[model samples]
Target: MSSWNSLWKWGSVALLAYVIVRGFSTPLQPGLVESSPSRLAPGKHALTLQAVGQPFAEPDAESADFSLILRSGKELVRTDITAITPHSVEADVIIPEAVPSPAMDAFLFTPEAGTLFLGNAFFVEDAAVGPLPADLRAEAPTEVAPDLGFSFPYQPTIVESIRNLLWHVPMWFAMFFVMGIGFVASLAQLRTGLVKWDLRAEAAVRTGLVFGILGLATGSLWARFTWGAWWVSDPQLNGALVTVLLYSGYRVLRAALGEDERVGRIAAVYNVFAFVMLVILLMVLPRYTESLHPGKDGNPGFNSYDLDNSLRAVFYPAVIGWGALCYWMYTLRLRMNRVEHHLLTR
Candidate 1:
């Protein structure tokens, strides 16, 4: 038992170490990060687009083979590449008097890199005409084979911050995993009237709270970079905050009922209720309403495209490793509670 426990503990540490090193070090695939003058006017316009991650155009690659396309509904309007750099490109796009759609999505077909996409990149407004005539529209781009390499998908808004998915998301998952254990333990305490179950429940809540707080902090940092705010009014974000606050009340309830013989039973009941609210607020409510947060109503999550096989390789280990570490903390706290109880009775 001792040998197996040691193996599990160290295995978690090693897996977390691997996740940290690989998660941070991996490069993102090439994609457009920003474009100057997001709104384009009718007629010929000079545009510059900045790129993040790997180089889109190869050093030896010719400009003739590369193409920039703007999708206005079904019509593909081609752009003339004026100049190309490793990290940025300048182009001359001739916007028709009118387009099929006002919002244009950009796609860069590169020889070295795959087709990079930026949805709603440039908005066409106040054009001289309505939709472009079919005869005036450009040809669709030729298909180019993607450069198959191990890298995270480059998201337009998320970009390098996509790496946070490995840390922020898994922390919440691990917290929920441990907190579920506490909820079950609390139920057992209420049924059996056992102090041991109460201790286990308390330890689990304390350990789970640590990860919960970390999840919020990491999520806040991620939001600051991507959403330009430390916090948002989004339902999912608020739900997470409320869930943490509710669990925190569990500890306060235990402290308030000190030395009472029924303290364990009362706190156990509170914890059971708290876990139910956790599911209702964090899981159920977020799905029903519209949210800026991904995986919610109308918004396709990172899992749809961003969480590829390369990310999963590091991500799965992170969840397991963090979960193991959380359980280890619970066990330590449970032993401490047992020791304290023995001392008080003596």
Candidate 2:
């Protein structure tokens, strides 16, 4: 058992080191970053598109093979490429008088980079004529297999910020894991009135709160980049803040009671109630409301198609590594609490 325990402790450290190095170092997949003249009008329009991450097209590569497509509803409008550079492309797109939808999505199909998509990239307005005839519409390009390399997926607004997934998300998972432990310990304390269980419950709360605070900080930083704000009024964001504040009250309760004999039982009961509120606020309420946050409402979460195989390879280890580390902190705090109690009594 001792050998197994030591192996896990050291293994957690190794896994965390790997997550930090690999997660930060991985490159994002090639993607179209921006387009000049985001709005479009009917007629011949010259456009410039800038790209980031890996190069999509070779300098000497033929521009004829690369296709730029604008999708409006079921219609696919093709564009003529005038120039192709390593990191940008120039295209001339003809817009007809009428279209199915005003909002158009853009896709760049290349031999090397697969398909790069930007949703709602261009808007069409004031087209006086009807949709382009079927014969003029370009055929969809052949699908290219994505390059299997160690890289993060490129999402439009997310870009390199997607790397935060490894840090911000796993911290919350770790907090939940340790907080659950504390909840269970609180229950056991209430049942048996044991001082050890109370100590464990208190330590777990303290340690889990540390990760919870980290989670909030990392999430806010990610939001600043993606949402263009340090904080948003979104349901998931508010719920997480409320849950953390609720758990924080647990610490205040412990401090107020001081050395009272009833402190253990009262704290245990409060911890139980706080855990229940954590579930309601963080888990239940967010799902039912409209939220800009992923995994809520109709938004697809990391658990869905967003978390591809490459991300999963690093993400799962991060979850386990952070959980183990948080639990280790809980154990150390529990021991310290026990020592303090003994010294005070003697």
| Candidate 2 overall lDDT versus native | 0.86
RMSD each, Å: 2.6, 2.4
| Model 1 lDDT-worst window of ten | 298-307
lDDT string for model 2 (118-234, tens) is 788888888654566675598997898887387887787788888788899899999999899999999999999999899999999999899999999999999999999999998
Candidate 1 whole-model C-alpha lDDT, 0 to 1 = 0.85
Task: List per-prediction Cα lDDT, in the order shown.
Answer: 0.85, 0.86
lDDT of 1 by residue, 107-148 (tens): 887877768888888999897546676655677667787775
Name the best candidate (by lDDT): 2
Clash totals, every prediction: 0, 2
State residue 147's C-alpha deviation in candidate 1, in Å: 1.5
